[model samples]
Target: MKLQDSVIAITGGGQGLGRAMAEYLAARGARLALIDLVPEKLEAAAEACKAAGGDARAYTCNVAREADVEATFASIIEDFGQLNGVINNAGILRDGLMIKARDGEISKRMTLAEWQAVIDVNMTGVFLCGREAATKMIENGDKGVIINISSISRAGNMGQSNYSAAKAGVAALVPVWAKELSRYGIRAMGIAPGFIETEMTASMKPEALEKMSAGIPLKRMGKPEEIASAAAFIIENDYMSGRMIEVDGALRL
Candidate 1:
């Protein structure tokens, strides 16, 4: 719970929100296990975490693969000698409308492959990693937390049927994990971010970004550090569990 020396594993820690959290938590003295599919990115992130004033190591693994998830968690525990928390943050965006039609005639439909890909990484990946993390925490007698990275698009946004479904599924798991893991002193929580200015959004045209920002009550996109701050708060607040913290600038999908 205390950031000082608490060992936390983060998926997708190579960049974006994951990297931001790694640095933020590291700055507060938490040890980090930065997991990602890309070895280079993981190495860089781990170094960055160390620069932020905490110990950190990198692991390369695919969250969508059960074997990878299992081995990764095991390795984390073996290296860190204790496990405290895991942030399920690895995800991919494959945005497309379920059906594209004009005058009732369908021009295109979301492919099964497309849907399955997102579900595998965004939904099932969370399941595998969360399961393995909780198991390790309990076996090691470490009280910890699980934080799922969801999105406001979980409310069902246009042009994102696959992503919406995947995010919604993870968000729904918050309560289930909390109720199940609480007996072992492990807590579960979720964060549903609205429009945030990450690498993905940073490349958008200025006009489009302005239009998107206009809808948010804050009239601006969120920063990755802000989301990281929310995550740190959740980990430190022992009483908070089974809740989804919306950092959306009051914007509704």
Candidate 2:
């Protein structure tokens, strides 16, 4: 499980916590296969990883697509000569209540499109990528790790029926994969982060962000690097699997 020279594929590597993980793991001498829907962002992340003194390549991919996930992993194995790990990090937020009420009357409801979009990327995407990664590792007889990025909202949050459901599904996949894939020498785990300071959260209004942070015991937001550190620990610790490590600064939502 050593990272040095190991090949790891990361989805959503274009920016945010995924990019931070790419940089951090790269600095530890891991080779990177950075995947994202945006070519520009993928290339930028690859360059950043290279600057951090790791061999890295960018693959433009939509993780939610079966063809894209399969093709991307094939490319990674071809380029790196092996697949050692994968991070299911690609996700999108389409937050809305199941039903919005105004004056005690139903006004708007969460659309099927919003719910399906989030499920496609955040849940199905993880399944596709994790399946491909496990297939490769098992075929090659390589012991590897899979990390899924979950959220505090997995506990369920108001105004986020879609997001919460998707994230909770992501967390549930961990133990199932761990038990199913362990015999093949693949370990599955999850990281559920609280309100981290990333582009996604930075978009919140200043007052809203402040109020959110005040609710956390730390009274502050977590940095992306902190989550990256947890990822590193999971990568190096072979015994860790089938469980989720919450990196939410003791925040329960």
Best by lDDT: 1
> How would you encode candidate 1's per-residue C-alpha lDDT over 43-132 as one tens digit per residue?
999999999999999999999999999998999999999999999999998888899999999999999999999999999999999999
How much does each candidate deviate from the true structure in C-alpha RMSD? Answer: 0.9, 1.0
Which 10 consecutive positions of candidate 1 have the poorest summed lDDT?
Answer: 244-253
lDDT per model vs. reference: 0.95, 0.93
Least lDDT summed over 10 consecutive residues: which range in candidate 2? Answer: 244-253
Q: What pairs collide in candidate 1?
A: none
Model 2 TM: 0.98
TM-score of every model versus the real structure: 0.98, 0.98
